[model samples]
Each structure stands twice: as C-alpha cells, then as structure tokens.
Target: MQEIHPLLQPKKYRFIDQSTLGPGFSALQSFAMDDALSISVGEQISPTAARLWVHHNTIVLGIPDARLPYIDKGMDYLHEAGYEVIIRNSGGLAVVLDEGVMNLSLIFPNSKDLNIHEGYDAMVEFVRFLFADLTDEIEAYEITQSYCPGKYDLSIGGKKFAGISQRRVKQGSAVQIYLDVTGSGYERAALLKHFYEISKLGEETRFEYPTIDPSVMASLNELLGTSLTVEDVRERILKQLSEFSEAVVTHPLEGEEIEWFTKRLDQMIVRNEKARENLK
Candidate 1:
C-alpha cells in the first residue's frame, strides 16, 4: 500500500458535510462552494478543508461536452429523462451525479508548491484508506470505456466506481471525486452513452470523446458485495477524516467567504448561460 500523502494528513481540518442537503443543493453551488473554500484556505482564513455533497439526478458536463455538435438535442434528451445538466469549471469529461453518488472535495493551500499529481495522489490515497477495511483490491487507473474516464479513476477488479478531477484557484487546490456508493453504475453509464450518441451524432471533432461501455462500471455495493448507502459512506468519510487530522471542525462560511461564494456562483451561472447560447 502507498503511504498517505502529507497533504492528506492535516493537523486540523474544516469538515463540511452537505450530503443531506437534498435535491435543493445544486451542483452549481457545489462547484462555487469549492472555489470559495479554495480561496479561503489559500488566503489563510481557514484550515485545510473537506466537503461532502450529493446532488439529485444531474449530469455535469465538461467544457468540451458543451461543444458537442448536437448538444442542444443532447441536453433536451437529458431534461426529458429528468436530469439537470451543467458545465463544470474543471477538468474531465461528463459525469453522473445523483442521490446515490457521494462527492468529496479536499481543499489544500499553497497550490504553487503542490504538484498537480500530488493533489490527485492525496485523493487516491485517502480513498484507499477510506475503504481499507472493506477490501484491499481497490485500484487507481484509467478505465477508458467508462464515463468520465481518467488516469485517477478508482476501481475494483476491472470495474470503475469513482472518478477524480482537480481545480486550482487562488493558490489553493481542490481535488474533487465522485464515488458511486450505491445504485446501478450501468444505468448511470448508459445515460452518458446515450448522451454522447445524441450529442456527437457520429460527428468527428478535434478532441475525442469517450466511447462509453456501461459494463465497465459498477457501484461499490456490487464490487464489494456489501450494502453501503451514501449515508454509510458519509459516516465512514468523517471517521476516516478524524483519523487523518488532529482535530476535525465544522466551520460555516462567513463574511468574505460568503461573498466569494456568491461571486463564484454568479460566474458559474454566467458560464452555463453562455455555453447554452452557443447551441442557439
């Protein structure tokens, strides 16, 4: 087993658990919240922070996804299928987020000194530790046929259960990951497969989008042969975080942090609107 990165072992961590916020807690706000936390940590106004969140039936698209030849039609299909769509201000292809998916963001300061791979490694190591008790077969590598495939995709055997992406801002880094803790990973991947078929319509482009194969994905419950709910994983995360830190504190955003969140949220909304305008 690889040693946990020092970045993942903070002396103290500000832990924010928003997983129970329900459907009203939009992914739009989640991304903005991460930026806010990044700035807060970078400015030394807050300690290294971790946030857990879940959104209901949303498909977060990458910037390139927004440029798909028939994306307006693709968005319409998703809307009809009862999924909200948004373009994220981060790196990676499209990914599914729903009640069964648990998302985590680890915000670290001094990004200038943090190598990009270090941020990714910290997340990989932390996740390995999160479920070390349940199974030791967890692996990190690109699951090319899976939706949102990446070099840091977490898997068991040959099936992927999670994907990691990172964003850097104001000298802080947010290494974000989405874990498919429950539900059907095949159904989720199928959604994206249909989405890409409609969005690209067999049209070729400069950047190649993934050719998704639903079988390449599976929920943790399926892989580990254990019934693990998002809530179950939520508790596990908090417990693991406590082990990694000397103290775990829940600190709400205040004053300037609130202002920063609002500013970043507005920017996200504007970006989404502009991306939509290109379709019209």
Candidate 2:
C-alpha cells in the first residue's frame, strides 16, 4: 500500500458542514461556496478547508452532457422524475445526488506547486484511510459502466461507490468526491442510464457516453454490510480529518468570502442558464 501524502494532512484545517441544510438549499450554492473557499484558502484568508455537502434529488451534469443531442428530452424526463438538473462548473459527466449521497470538497492552497494527479492521489489516499477499518479492498480505478466514471473512481469488489473530481481556480484547488453512503447506487445508475437512453437514443454524438451497467454500482452500506447513513459517514469524515490535522477550525463564510460566493454563485447560475436553456 502506498503511503498517504503529507500535503493531505494539514497541520490546521477548516471544517464546514452543509449536509444538514434543508431541501430548499440549492446545490448551486455548494458549488459557489467551494469556489469562494478555494480562492480564500489560496489567498491565505482561510485555512485549507474540508466541506461536507448533500443535495437532494439533483442530477449535476457536465458540460458535455448539456450537449447531448436530445438533452432537452432527457431534461424533461429528469424533471418528471422529480430531479432538479444543473450543469456544474467542472469536469465529469452526469452524477446523481440525493440524501444518501455525501459530497466532500477539500480546498487547498498553492495549486501551482501541486500537480493535478497529486491532488487526486491525496483524496484517494484520504478516503482509503477513512474506511481503513471497514475494508482494505477499496480500490481506485475507472468503473467504466458507472456514470462520471474516471480513473479515480473508488470501488470495492468490482462495484463502484464513489468518484473524485477536481476544480481549480486562481492559486487554490478544490478536490471533490461524492460517496454513495447509503441507499441504492444501482438505482442512481439506472436513472442515469434511462436518461442517456432518452437523451441520445436517436442522436449520433461524437463524444462517447458511458454505457451504464447498474450492477457495477453499489452503496457503501451494501458493500460493507452495515447500515450506515450519510450522517454516520459524515462523522467518519470528521474523525478522520481530526486525526489528520492538529486543529480543526469551524469557519463561517463572511464579508469578502460572502462577496466571492455571491459572485461565483451568479456565474454558476448564468452557466446553468445556458446549459438548461433548451430544457427549460
């Protein structure tokens, strides 16, 4: 097993939990908040932060997903299925987010000094450390049949439960990962599969969309044979983060941070507007 990097273990870190935010709180705000914190941490206004977030019944699409030939049709399907859709300001294809899915963003400073893979390796190592007691089988590799499949996809026994992605701004970087903590990963994959079936059935696209196989995905609860809620894993995250840092500071977004958030949030809205124009 490879050793965890020292960069991931900051001496001091900021912890922010937005997972308890009610349904009315949009995932859009989470994206903007991360971007703002990334800039703040990069500029030394805030410590390197770990933020926990969850969004209910939302399908966050990548830029390419918005270009699907019959995406408007798929958008209607998602709307009818009670899932709010938005295009994220980062890489990766469509991914499902519900109460059972937990999102983590590790914002770090000095992006210029860290290579992209190093950032992803830090996240992969952190996650491996988080669940070290549960299972040593957790592996990071592309589960090609899963939505938002990537080389850093985290899985156990051939079933994917999480995916990692990175977004960089200014001199700060946010390495994000979404873990299917509870409920059904297969159901989520099925939803995305149906979406692609409807969205690209008749269209010939240049981009190679994933052929989602529902069996290839399963939640951690199912894989570990433990009834773990997102809150449970949230606690696990906090505990592991505490072990990695000397002090964990709970910081609130204020003043200039709020301003940055508002600006980035508006930009996110504008980006989504263009992405969802035909769908709406």
* Predicted structure with the largest lDDT when compared to the true one: 1
lDDT of 1 by residue, 163-256 (tens): 9999999888999999999999999999999999998889898889999999999999999989999999989999988988899999799999
Q: Rate the local accuracy (lDDT) of all candidates.
A: 0.92, 0.92
* Overall local distance difference test of candidate 1: 0.92
Candidate 2, residue 9: Cα displacement in angstroms equals 1.6
Instruction: Give the C-alpha miss distance for residue 249 in model 1, angstroms.
Output: 0.6
lDDT of 2: 0.92
Query: Could you tell me the TM-score of candidate 2?
Result: 0.97
Model 2 clash pairs?
A: none
| Stretches of model 2 off by over 4 angstroms after superposition | 278-280
